[model samples]
Target: QMATETRTHGDYTVGWICASSIERRAAMAMLDELHEPLPTPEYDRNIYTLGSIGKHNVVIACPPMGTAAPYIISMTNIFRAINFSLLVGVGSGIPPDVRLGDVVVGTLEGHNPKEMMLNPLVEAENSVHVETWAATPPQPLLEALKKIKTEYELSGSRIPEYLERLKRDSPALASRYLKSDSLQDLLFDADYGHVTPDFANLSFIPREENDCRFCDKTMTVKRKPREMRVHYGLIASADREIKSAPLRDRLCRNFGGKVLCIDMDIARIKILFPSHYPCLVVRGICDYADSHKNMEWRDHAAIMAAAYAKDLLHEQDLQILEWLTPVDYGPRHRDFLRRWQPETGLWLLDSAEYKTWLSTKKQTLFCPGDIGSGKTILTSAVINDVKTRFQINPVVGIAYIYCDHRHKETQQIDELIASILKQLTQKLFSLPDCIRQMYEKHKYGQTRPSLNEILGVLHTIIGEYSRVFIIVDALDECPTSSGCRQTFLKELSNLQNQFGVNCFATSRLDPDIIAQFRTNSISLEIRENAKDVQLYVKRYMEQLPAFTELDQWQQETMLVKVLEHVDKRYDLA
Candidate 1:
């Protein structure tokens, strides 16, 4: 262990320890870009090194890309398995019997056969051999397969691919790629598999090598009596990396008789040197042909083919989501504020107090303002203010209080709760991963959120998403019992004091509602803020294109006249 040398890299140092690997070489290449290769010791004949990733140093060491050595070991969250900063098992598929052409879409069981009965050629070959080697997939794996299939079914028709989209917009990719009937067929899920753009090079495997008895019989691999194409999981190894599509798939299909991903020796590496090592696979679609026969797919072509493959199958589903990330797209909450273009926090309402009240982050306030006072417009402004000021990017949200004047009591409370839930969901439309994970943990959306649950969601938004803001218009119109109103107000006060989220309410100033808030919660009268009202009215008029032509004096004069003229008698509402 002492014989090994070490050197400084960022905060950490690079050195060679006893542990060694093919992946070590690839990792070194990447690490080397920052600096020269540093050597250390062969503690257990292992490869170890320390290099700076940024300011901090990373101790990266791997056995190899293709050997039966652990492909990776990462203690930190930020990891890269050769461009797969994130790798997930979308799931697996069977092979051979299931001719998996590039871009082909099928269910888990589509590649599996319930029974297997081969011709006489296989019958004479080895009944005992088939019985011994034929695969009976694990029931759990099968069940997972079924679930994936069901998910696909629920998704309905696929979204159009970039190629189809480009054709509509420019007609250029269509002209070039659409030339081939095989290519033209790639428009949608035209077939089981969307042929990858790249052609496969089957030269690596001897054409005769694919011959079989009961199934594809290379040497060790014995296919089931009834064959189906399925992508099997396997490990890979390399002195560096075996990125060649033909090589990877060929070795996997020919040698291991399994589906191929990036890391060639993960299974072997795990077995030989066990650890929760990460491995990544990124394959280009070189060919879709079942036979060794070749077509137009080549290296660059294969790259495109793979790109298209993801587009057709996985990427299509992810396209909508791509814009969802905060990185790719700016915060939607901010976007809403920018779009609304509110000048100040006040939402236009008959009562000045309620107008200012709307600024609260979360509340189901009753708007006591007179009718036609622009309550809805004012409420929208309140929500917009929170969104802009706090820079809260809500993933789910909506802004409104639906009122069925037809039924204000029992039906109204239920409706109010439902309405709030809907808006909350919109603000949380794209729930934070933590919130989503937690919600999924508790089965939230599956059931209406309890008051506590709703509060919890607000907390999550405050924690993970951003500052919470809610605008509920005209709760007074809701015909629920005074107690129900009190409960709702109580919850709001609790939320406000607890989470610092504000709620703004507009109502007709019902004495019962007022008494409820005063007794059970911190209540504020909303009818009297005349200055804020005047400002809002003026601001609203100022937005008119012609307002720019008017001088400041004219603006004030117009606002005062409108404010004084509008009927504010409490008896009318």
Candidate 2:
């Protein structure tokens, strides 16, 4: 039940910027779920495919062949919540350590031809100082790189499995994506030229059809055959594509022979975007950056790059889940939700008031009932439903608090609000710098954040999301003697008024709690919920020993009696 139709620009977090149609197809093939196309601004020229890979909702797009600069900036604007950008495609591989179909993850260095001093660069061993623009992948991507390398070292890369899935899912594109045996990956000597024998005529035509068929085999560099591997290092970026072996080798030499690949897109992106814009360039080596370049390995290289990017994203999702937080209501929510009968909450889920709360902003749904009336259980169901519906979109934050009188000492106003902040912040790609700074400031002082400090962080963090749902279960259980409950309710009200955060709460029909929500929320009293009570009684009876062994009349009599007793107080648990 993916609600693709209702998705907006903010729903997407990962921007997969491709250079060619093959790369776009390869990216699409790697997606676990393909989302419907979202409407774009009329001025946006780039076409897009919305999809999901692991936990990330990715928006894949290919800029018009030679015009990537404008479209990439447009992509940044269009996908407003994009924290991670992946420049995925095929590029010319440098010699020695790189080969066709090998993937290159970039710690990109943007170079300008004018700024590079090539006059003294001819001393083959000497490193030349060039004024270059450099950008590293964000912290999360770098962490993912480390994790993936370790995993690959232990059990090998997942590329083969992903390729198999591609073959099974898209039969038509399988042959194209798969490596061809006939496409021999040849590396020529740096001095070898692909020009014909008539050297003085200045006719710049290749001797072979973009291959080394007519070239001397004795000049070829023999390499060992091995499985495709990922190489991480400096990737040089310039204004134009690299086609000459001498220039390619010189660029590599200038960088102390650390550049693994060369591409034309990365430089433009670095110049067009902000200095700190986080992006990782993944290039599959389609050809050696020499005279003999061809399209033979382009498809295979694109697929390899896409596969590596997908694996990195999966690792990133795992890292996000492991983010340390001060408070976690997940265990409490899970405990309560375990008692939920599958179809018992249909009445609330299908009700007009609940649907309205989900669709409208700054809305609240208050479920108040007597003690043991199943308010907490119904609250769990609502929390589960909200999570399921909005899980794919990272910008849609969902946080829940399960308050208990037993833990009133620990569940103070600040603690409850901090938990909400923790949940929402975890949904982001990285913690907001402001939140990080606040934590550091308090951490150094060895003091806890005051209620105002926590609320301030909460306000800032909530602004990062396009929408937020805050569910507080058993609100009446919060201590009222110290005005903790009042303060908590006021903060929720402020968040709702200022940020349009949706608020959902369940509690006993205490006069104070009822008065707080009476004017602003849609009230749903949980008492004598006949269908839920009947469903629970039937399920409980089925688990009993003699209930199923009895006749229909006896069963009916037992069921009626149980329902009658339970109907007075519908806790069901």
Q: Which ten residues in a row have the lowest lDDT in candidate 1?
A: 126-135
Model 1 over residues 89-159: C-alpha lDDT tens digits?
Answer: 11111233332232222222223312122222223332110100112333433443344344335432111
TM-scores of the models, in the order given: 0.32, 0.52
Candidate 2 Cα misplacement greater than 4 A, ranges: 1-5, 108-134, 195-209, 320-573
Locate the minimum summed-lDDT window of 10 residues in model 2: 124-133
Q: Which parts of model 1 are misplaced by more than 4 Å?
A: 1-367, 391-467, 481-483, 516-573
CA lDDT of 557 in candidate 2? 93
Clashes of 1: 89
Report the number of clashing residue pairs per model.
89, 0
Whole-model Cα lDDT per candidate?
0.37, 0.79
